[model samples]
Target: MAILRRQFAAALAVTGLGVGLAGCAVSQDRAGSTPVGVADSLYWNGPILTMNDAQPQVEAVAVRAGRIVAAGTRADVARWQGSTTQVVDLQGRTLIPGFVDPHSHLGGVGLQAIAANLLPPPDGPNTGIAQLQETLRRYINTSPDVRELQVAFGFGYDDSQLSERRHPTRDELDAVSTTLPIVAIHQSGHFAALNSKALERAGITAQTPDPQGGVIRRRAGSREPDGVLEENAYFGALQHLMPRLTVEQSVGWLEKSQALYLQFGYTTVQDGRADPGGVDTAIAAAKMGKLKVDVVSYPDILTMGEGRFMQGPYYSRNYQQHFRIGGVKLTLDGSPQGKTAWLTQPYLQPPAGQPASYAGYGVMSNAQATAQIEKAFANNWQILVHANGDAAIDQMIQGVQAARARYDSAGTLQDRRPVLIHGQTLRRDQVDKIKALGIFPSLFPMHTYYWGDWHRSSVLGDPRAQNISPTGWVLAQGMRFTTHHDAPVVLPSSIRVLDATVNRTTRSGQVLGPEHRVSPWIALQAMTLWPAWQHFEAEHKGSIEVGKLADLVVLSGNPLTVPHAQLIDLKVLQTIKEGVVVYQAP
Candidate 1:
């Protein structure tokens, strides 16, 4: 440490840093530490876009002990340059604060990785059941883990993309292997299909009554289970199917997920809807010192009990070595693209089993959900409810209003920063209510890029479909909102998130809503600064300003100056967390 300090001093003198360069070596206590001294590192010579509106841009940033000490023109921050200070030459590249994706499933990413890939273009090429089966068979044949488990587990099956234009049936999956239990989860993560053998294991039978808030799609006429499960039924089935992963195994999966997130320039990620077991695994990983990226988890309000929610030791908002239990995650309904979200208007084209008037069903009764919300608030936990359907949003609105009235009727609203997750089908009036109530919205607008056409033609007719995420509506009200890719539901691609937010373009080269499109700068803010604010970490994160954590990323090109089409092609050149490089492109 002494030698390093000497080097820092000598380097500062040699670099001709003006004014008291030697004084930088004298560290001070809390009351009076010279803010702009010889920095441990400096990044200069590029477009440094700080999301801070005060000093929107800076040429150089100096870091001391993992916190920014200087951010200004090259000459202004040059005094921090020293021999020991690692200087990073940006070489005309672009630098912004590291992307903060508030609504993702980092832990789920590992689970998704272990399963067979059944997604459509860009990730996998399974456009039909044949390709899906091929991919499953390939995973079974190649993955020794699958062979040992004696079950074929796959995820990311999208009926919307299927050539058959429907979910694969049990008989089709039985074709994979009649003896082995097979389960293929839908891309929405709200549904799953089980083969005959898997169904028998989960005890879903012809006589078994449909669980409340969930469905077991039956075969043509009779009550024979068709093996497809939605909402709570899917979660119930998964409770039976998911194996007991060891702590080490869970850590390995988290590490794998972290590596992928780091590549995408994610310093902070989320495990949005961690079940109790998932939360345990995350805590175990944190205690063992295995976490590399910050993970804020929200255990499902339904799956976990009040006792657990009230007494769980992992339920703190503070960073406990890269892990924190943000709050409780409640799912009010299913995905809009799956034609299962509880919408006010009927779906343009309902799925096979439902009537034309079928709008979707809530995953829980209003009484049950409101009870959970009341309990969560009673315990002082921040609530981030998942309400993709407009009706579900209504549930959230009523529930939150009642909770606030019951608990803090003095107009405080608990100051909990209650969140409305997804809100894909959120209405404009709800936008006003959300703003008035001080609820934060972490919206999923990538639906425009991934499922816009499907939403327009089948899930929701044109008018409603065009407003899926409605980020622009929130902006119009002068309310702040954040955007996300909801990793595992989709690959948490940062550029793709930004691109979709900025363009609102569907895959078919059509703009879903031109007015809904935000600027590239606003899109960047959604990913960086705004999400930080949503998570209540804006002070230390969100911007490249002095005294904040030097968590930043360098891109191959500036997102602000890029053409819309080329935004998706931009690469993350380097990712720095607390001024230390964590990832760099090959």
Candidate 2:
């Protein structure tokens, strides 16, 4: 690997090809001093997984001016070769279209980059409450920024995987800090635990009533908040406790987040839920020429309803400096792993302080949700709804149906491509409705690996658990669904997304839903082709074909031919965006 890196680097240096980000100098002109029919780069000598159904694999692909100029046999494409062209020898590796994110928060993933990691095994070291506390303490002690902020925030802690199998108490967090405020967000991001001082900082008290669609988990048999907040309660507290970042810090975090995505071979990513402020920050980053890969942001519809940002140049399908406001986002419910996702059926074991008949509740009433959807449709804005549980999915369906009925007289509302994110508990009956209504389902099947056991034993139990995400039913209906990592909930690891989508393997080595598992080829399409269509970018971004943007990823192994159990072992060796090498493995 070291020798390969040195050789690649030496070759680039000799060819005068500077390896940097999107802003780096590269020859893009086809009519200037450069030859008209010449290629800038050529990739060949290994497997090429083109997501396009026609000519799925090719012997060679040629790129020039950030577009694929030719893709065919080596003998056929060699005509485009020129003296200055930089040839990339695959050396038995695999090349595929760059991944297009279906759902995730790049801004939240940026925040995750700066905060202490509290995720459990395979991602982080927080396997128990003690380890979590220790991790926070270490972060606070080591991070100068956290000390300056005077509030220590940690992300991705899952109570289900902890030794105690419960959220850390205020007292437990207090053990780490009493003077400095502390906030620990649940792995699902729907829940959070705050120390007493942090709770005070957020102004939560015993007298405070639970907010609508949210819960303040209290002490046993008492009204006193136990530091745990769910849904709206957590969202509110988080807003109050979040530290403000300077422009430089915000842009730096965005770059760091993009770097993480690039490392995992994502050339196009989604900021699935963005606020006005986040959109502004992304614009600033783009203006500074800092973005290497394309970023599509879906601002929260509840906050910005057909706002001025939608009227800007950044709102178009074509990226302005690699950033655009693709659409609006609406979140209907919370996370299933946290037991707060609105569900039609009662939870098998309710969280503490909830009744046995407790099924999670939606963030808004059906009328309110429908009105928002109507507003989105009225403006012809594409909308993405975050719905996890079946009940939430029901409300989403109702909202879409109402909106389409009112505004789709020409039968063209389907062209808007409304998306349903994280349909983890989608019912078999709802599959046909989703297909009929043109709801693009962007599911997080990675939940199978991250929280499959918890859902089986605590959240839903038995048969209900086996059908989570329900990829098979969508396939059965001859429909395509996109899969996502929902980053910050999980790292934006593309290989893990592929592995979980294809295997449905849990942390305990159990195949959670054998029936829902897909072939590696199908999984590739979900991450690449289907998601590109989801983002309205299929024409230029999905597959490796002539005239498409040269957005591609080089992998250590071929996904289709790799042993089923060894998918996780595959690595992203290099990420190329628009014929330029943006990220190469070190």
Among the numbered candidates, top TM-score falls to 2
lDDT of each: 0.83, 0.88
Pairs of residues clashing in candidate 2: none
What would the TM-scores of all predictions be? 0.93, 0.94
The C-alpha stretches of model 2 lying farther than 4 A from their native spots are 1-36, 410-413
lDDT (Cα, tens digit) per residue for candidate 1, span 494-542 = 9889999999888898999887899888988889999888888898898
Give residue 96's lDDT in candidate 1 (0 to 100). Answer: 94
Please write out the lDDT profile of model 2 over residues 243-269, one tens digit for every residue: 888888889989999999999999999
Residue 198's lDDT within candidate 2 is 98
How far residue 368's Cα lies from its native spot in candidate 1, in Å, is 1.7
Q: Local error of candidate 1 at 131, Å? A: 0.5
